[model samples]
Target chain A: MELKVYVDRLSQPSRAIVIFCKVNKIDFEEVGIELLKGQHLTPEFKEINPMGKVPAIVVDGKFKLFESHAILIFLASAFPGVADHWYPADLYRRAEIHSILDWHHSNLRHGSSFTYFPFPHELCSDETNVFQLNASSAGFIQNTLLAPLFGRSLNPQAAAEAEKVLSSSLSKIEALWLKESGQFLLGSSQPSIADLCLVCEIMQLEFADETDRNRILGPHKKIQQWIEDTKSATKPHFDEVHQTLFAAKVKLQMQRK
Target chain B: MELKVYVDRLSQPSRAIVIFCKVNKIDFEEVGIELLKGQHLTPEFKEINPMGKVPAIVVDGKFKLFESHAILIFLASAFPGVADHWYPADLYRRAEIHSILDWHHSNLRHGSSFTYFPFPHELCSDETNVFQLNASSAGFIQNTLLAPLFGRSLNPQAAAEAEKVLSSSLSKIEALWLKESGQFLLGSSQPSIADLCLVCEIMQLEFADETDRNRILGPHKKIQQWIEDTKSATKPHFDEVHQTLFAAKVKLQMQRK
Candidate 1:
């Protein structure tokens, strides 16, 4: 049996996997579990993933895997010919990739975590839980992550200096767009898992619509240009099949509304 | 240059890697990073690991790897003699192992996180991040993990009822502990990466003294018994190396007192 990816394009990890499969030409089946319908909470899905989260998969009827980073690494490991750069065999280069993956959960993951979705689970429940669904969580990120780090960022702001770097995380990315020397981050090398990660995270950030283009990704000159440039490179992958899935997802959201 | 393991035996992930190296018989030099001295926070080590965490390795003069589970999988992939069962060659089985590695972070790792030394940096400044190091961050596991599934675990009320199984998460493991059985967790198997993870997580529930013993791990039968048996089974890697580290760690705490 071929590989099967159980995904919802709405999920950042799921999008990463879809893009990876497209770029690498991996043939697999697609199974969508609607998050809004609470399908993930169902017992059947729980058997596949006790955590009841998405971006899970069933491989050859024998193994079930969760955690997007782990899955991405596994795919690259199993497919060697993808290129030496994607996951280099050399120690330091491999270590560099590993380092990025490691930093992700604590850093980039935090950025992704703060974005808000329109769920009422935390608020509707007891006051003690204090967990906000999606949007407020994004606000949580702005304060805990974007705000403080930005305040402490690149420029030595006389005041609010920290905030300048905050936007560039988004904008510096835009600056990279301006300097399209390489198809992916980490230079003209084959896009490593980091590229997949950035695409999802950037998409999620843009989804928030809070990012101001000019100062953030734009100010860097390269990142702003790179941001749009990277998206365009991957445009063909998301075209025929991805558009259908994306439209269907939008319809699903409207139905929820 | 040979591989170098930077470890403190008392740490969970550190012990897992140490045990893997011993069991696999991979040759390596040992270098200690003094956790008590706060060596990890130093500028020099930061270059080695930006995360400033334990159980890191510098492999073959170049690769520096952190995150114990990731290291464990890498070792399995890098070393030829290590049984495939530990990591598994089949895609799905590997995925199952990967799932646990990921889930363990929120489940088993969460359980383990609750059992910290509760150390703080400043009685002088009264900066109470230490006091605020609430085990409560891990309370979700009690409600979600132990109460429903494991039953009687660390529950003060059921402390006596489920004492045996509750103590070690290994009462059933008694059957698996026999010498002649020879196999490890999966079957008459040496052990898979899954076993490595469990060994690491279980070790974290250990405490320093009699008072601590009464607190949780000591009072419970299954838990205590499991700790004893497993530690005995893996004696060489720990009692020799980890015990030394553990003693020094205790001494450091006593000095603080």
Candidate 2:
């Protein structure tokens, strides 16, 4: 069985899937779909995922799937060598993970630095760039990081609102999911897909200005430690998959100077 | 094993879980948490779901779970006599359904009429109502239907923006999931949990003023038919669970006169 993962590492969920595959030793070819270049929107890519989103996969060149949570579940369930802890076979445990994954979308994903970008058309003359960045999957970077990177002022109100939601989300995670003893979410000894997915999401804040990133993430000490724990558990693969985003972050900092 | 489902039929996902249990003949007690009355915010409900959202469940008075999609999956997986089509044991088929369910949160739920409500504080002097409605789960009705019902003008820009996202989401669902031969999503012969979840989400449009509701939902003929098909498949339970929403719709229409 051949598997091909189409991804753009800059996208949070895309990075999560890539890191998961690497850590689990899932044999698959990583096919990059550049969000900035409009690669995901091309007709050829659309055939793989008609939604025109990345972090999609094709198996044996016939079956196709999109949505990172689904792809992670499929990978965990279908792959033979993947540890059960990644997605436990136990019905109750799996359902608990699913609850976090589902909640992540609307709350953490929606409220985090990744809130959908509403580009002001007048500010950006390049229609192609605007359109590509407008795609929901790619909207995050443009909204939180790219705007400032490109010398466009971030909308203060939107930023404030996003920060408020993000802060509240972090607090909830700290109070509800993180336990006093457990290293991972829900007190699990091993990291689940929920950990990988949410950690990747919070990692997107690395692209934000250091002050803003710290301000938003600072209060939640447990979440910060949990993120570190998840990264450590995943080993070199976590940082390996995030190289693109980290590089971009350095570039943004350099450009700011 | 005893199961208790905490829900409010007025919430779309809450109703979906209720309908799923009733249709599958799963023995569960439904505990209503009235969102409007701030019942979900109380200390007791938080014990059931620390996140304080409805559509949570407790199993045998010990284990608790939240998130409607997760709850539905748990119900389908944990309970006997639930048809396979609802959540197939087949890895690929279940993954396909998961893809849609995950997508529903960010794209369909976020973009549809249920986009998070940012109520203008001064517009409503009743602090309690504002606080209760501000809770993410209960925000939808206030934004689309209740605002107008209570004589507040809907923000045109936000409405237009929501419509654009909703339209694009519906189009994607039509082009990608619906097939000419099948009545349910992903061309399944029987309705899956994906069908029930999405159909219930779109059904929230019924609370919108008729012209806006029809105008927004009118273009997607396949989706319209699919919603009907799913309703028929689920039988009396579908409409039975939605009675609260439907009744509220009637009240809204009466007030508009």
Candidate 3:
């Protein structure tokens, strides 16, 4: 099956999907949709994902799918060589992972830079124009990093609020999911898609100034270790896919300096 | 196998799970954890769900699970008699449903009464006290309805903002998911858990005044029909499970009168 993966590495979920594909050795073609340049808003990209978001996939040029978590599940279940631990086959264990994934969407992911972005007009825009607002506009990452990159003023109140949500999400991961022994979330020996998705989300904080990032992430020791563990388990692919994001971080830092 | 469901009918996902079980003829005992009373915050409930949210379940007195989408998936997969239409066996079809489910959590659900609730200090609270703020404080439903229930004055600005987000979410559902040919979401002949979860979420808007609800929901004609179709397909159980919500709506209306 020919799988065409549409992604923008700057987007957290996009990076997770790329890393998953690479680690699992899934044969796929990567098509970039740059969010910063408004590439994702093009009419051509709309056909692939009417949502006009990145981290979409087209399978064998027939079936199309969006939403990174769903794509990850599809890849894990459909691919033959993907290790079972990535998405376990046992019904109960799989359900637990689903809980985490869903929680992440509403809780951690929402609190992150993704949904917290303020797009006042998009809220009331027509179908053609709705949600055209990029997520990188006004969230935690944007407030700390992207705001400067885009020549926008930081909203300190919004940033503080987003940080609280993100920190609470991290604390939940540490207290509820992280085990005393296991390196990965849900206390599993191997990292699951939830780990990759959430860690990749937290990794975006790297774009923030070192002081700000540390202040936000410093309290979550278990989460810190889990990120390292997830990065290690995924190997070169994790760092490889994140190269774009890290490069962006360095560029942003240099600009700040 | 024995199943115990802990829920509060006031919570959207909790109602969805209850309705799903009732419609599917799943034998499960319902345990109420009232949100207004802050019952979910108790330590006993925390044992069942560390997140302290509702619609959690325990199977045969051993296995525990939370998050409505995950619980629905578990129930659909684990139960013998559940129809395939609710959650299809095909991997691709299932992934499509997952896409919708995840999208609902971040979009419709977030913009609704759940996440938009402003909990100022909860943002910085420790793990022991985090997220204790109830959802029915400052969202579309809360701002339009429940704010008065707790004697809290409505914040018109926040309500208008939430309405914009909620309306945009509804527009996306109408534009992207609902089809001209089918009565159910994703153009399916039968209702899926995605339909149940999302419909239940929209159903909460019934609490708002008639004019406010109409002004918001009136624009989305297809969504209106689809809600009715889903209700019809699910038969008595749909209305049965929603009786509490509808009753609350009537009471809130009477209070206004």
Candidate 4:
């Protein structure tokens, strides 16, 4: 049996995984576990990934694995002939890539929180919160304390707080990551999985209102260009996989009306 | 030139890096970045690691790298002849290890927050807060709102909340990781760096009040044993490197009096 990869294009990590597979031409079956539909939470999917998260895979129909960064490394390592720059053997280059990927978890990936919150969850038991269903991954934050406080519209205080957190994180990226060189992180000519991992995260801002998105991304010219560079490098696969994001944006817009 | 590693052993990630180098017999110089004294914050050291964090290495005195997980992987990948199990060639095993390490950044590593919050940053602000000085990391968290709220003593509300977060993280370890047959995580019999990264995090709980630590750790028998098993596998390096933890505990006790 061929390797089977489970993902939802709605997820940033999942989009990275799909693009990596497609760019590298790694043959595998794509299994979509729609997070908004609560598909990942099902008992059946739990057998594949107990954590109920996405970007998980089954190798040869038996071995199971999760975590998008790990999966990216595994694919690159397992299929070395496909591309060296993605995860190069040069020890220092690989180490630099490793450093960024590890840091991405708490840092740049905070985009998940910045974009997710400010939207409503179940506002009250009696009133089925339409925003909860309409909101994407950030709504899954499980902050029961703040859920009731945020009604249909964005919570101003929470939105400001989220923007602060996101801005600091972005500033660090612009200051620390971009300093090295070139079109991508670590100054590499080709965009590595690290590039994919982070660019996909920045791509999530598309779900937010244009004003909020601009507020978060506007200052960082390098990051904006890096995203474009990553897009061009990945080609049709990048736009194709992110089609779901456009769809979500349209749906969220319709709900706003 | 030999590899130069910057560390302050009081930091858990630094301790793990020290232990990895010692066990692997990787020749290097250990440059202690005195966090307690605000050494890492200095302009000179900032040149080495812009993040101002420890457990960074200057490979061959030129190429600099940070983040302990990445450093550990670098050592394993760079010097594969030392031991295969540290980071094996088998794709699935490596993937599983990668999964655990990534999960660790957010989950198991939360112990740092739980253990460190009760201490004041300026117990003797004039004297440089050496315990705070020696404490290389906990200060790195910029949650000023939560910091003031925690006060000098363990806030019951915060401690209870911390316990809830920690217990949930540990339960996942017991349920998902310990299920494998070996003594270590994944039941491989040999402890991997994934084992080192996590066990080191748990070991930091040595700083927490015994009551609070026990409250959080009590139910997880398998995890406790795994900690011991990881210690035994790593042997002298684990104990020797962790001596700093014991000394810090003594200092914290003195402050309590």
Model 1 alpha-carbon miss at residue B89, Å: 3.9
**Clashing residue pairs in candidate 3, if any?**
none
Off by over 4 Å in 2: A115-154, B114-153
Error of 3 at A151 (Å): 6.8
lDDT for each of the candidates? 0.53, 0.76, 0.76, 0.71
Candidate 3 lDDT by residue in tens digits, A194-232: 999899887867666778778888887888888898999
Per-residue accuracy of model 1 over A2-90 as CA lDDT, tens digit each: 68887766566777777877777777787886675767667987777655677777778756777787788777777654656666766
Of 1 and 2, the candidate ranking higher by TM-score = 2
The candidate maximizing lDDT is: 3
Candidate 3: CAPRI quality band: medium
Off by over 4 Å in 1: A60-63, A77-96, A121-188, A209-233, A238-257, B81-83, B121-188, B208-233, B244-257
Residue B46 displacement (Å), model 1: 2.0
Worst 10 residues of 3 chain B by lDDT: B124-133
* Model 4 misplaced stretches (Cα beyond 4 Å): A117-158, B115-155
* True contacts reproduced, candidate 3: 0.86
Backbone clashes in model 1: 38
Clash pairs (backbone) in predicted model 4: A116-A138, B36-B133, B36-B134, B129-B133, B130-B133, B130-B134, B182-B187
The positional error of residue A111 in candidate 1, measured at the CA in angstroms, is 3.8
Enumerate the candidates' DockQ scores in order: 0.22, 0.59, 0.58, 0.53
Chain B TM for prediction 2? 0.87
Please provide, for model 4 over A82-145, each residue's C-alpha lDDT reduced to its tens digit, 9 standing for 90 to 100.
Answer: 6898988788888899899887765555434443323333321100111232221222222322
